[model samples]
Target: MFVRIVKMSFEPSNIDTFLKNFEIKKNDIRNFEGCRFLELYRDKNTTNIFFTYSYWDTEEALDAYRHSDLFKGIWAQTKPLFNDKPQAWSVDKLESLT
Candidate 1:
């Protein structure tokens, strides 16, 4: 399994637009092939910051989604709202202490 996290900071005045766009695309993204889980998070103190957390069955699956038209469309609607460059991390399960 692969885990992906993306941290995005939106221009303060554009937050609502970003949220609405995200809301529109969330289901399609979640239903994409190989996507096992998906979530969105907001920073408690940094009100303009948000994160996208997702799980993919494999890296290839993630790569496919990244190259897909769905991503292109959503990103086109998203990039203009950014206040800073976004950051992303891809990881795999190593172990769970519990």
Candidate 2:
């Protein structure tokens, strides 16, 4: 499996807007081709910080999602809400307890 994690810090006043946008797209994203899992996480100490942790069947599967129109539209709306450049990583599992 390919794992992707995106860490984002939202503009304080734009956090709600970001959440609303994310809520609207989350389901479609989960249902996208080759998606195995999807989740959203928040930083306990930083209310405006969030992360998306997802699993794809392969790097190519993730690339397909990134190239889709759904991604283009959602990302256009999402990009301006960031307080900082987002951090992301694509990796394969070394080991997992579960």
Q: Which of the numbered candidates is closest to the native, going by highest TM-score? A: 2
Kindly give the stretch of ten consecutive residues in candidate 2 with the minimal lDDT sum. 89-98
- lDDT tens per residue, model 1, 34-90: 999999999999999999999999999999999999999999989999999999999
Per-candidate TM vs. native?
0.95, 0.95
Q: How many backbone clashes does candidate 2 have?
A: 0
The TM-score of candidate 2 is 0.95
Relative to the true structure, candidate 1 reaches a TM of 0.95
lDDT of 2 by residue, 1-98 (tens): 98999999999999999989989999999999999899999999999999999999989999999999999999999999998999999988889895
Clashes of each: 0, 0
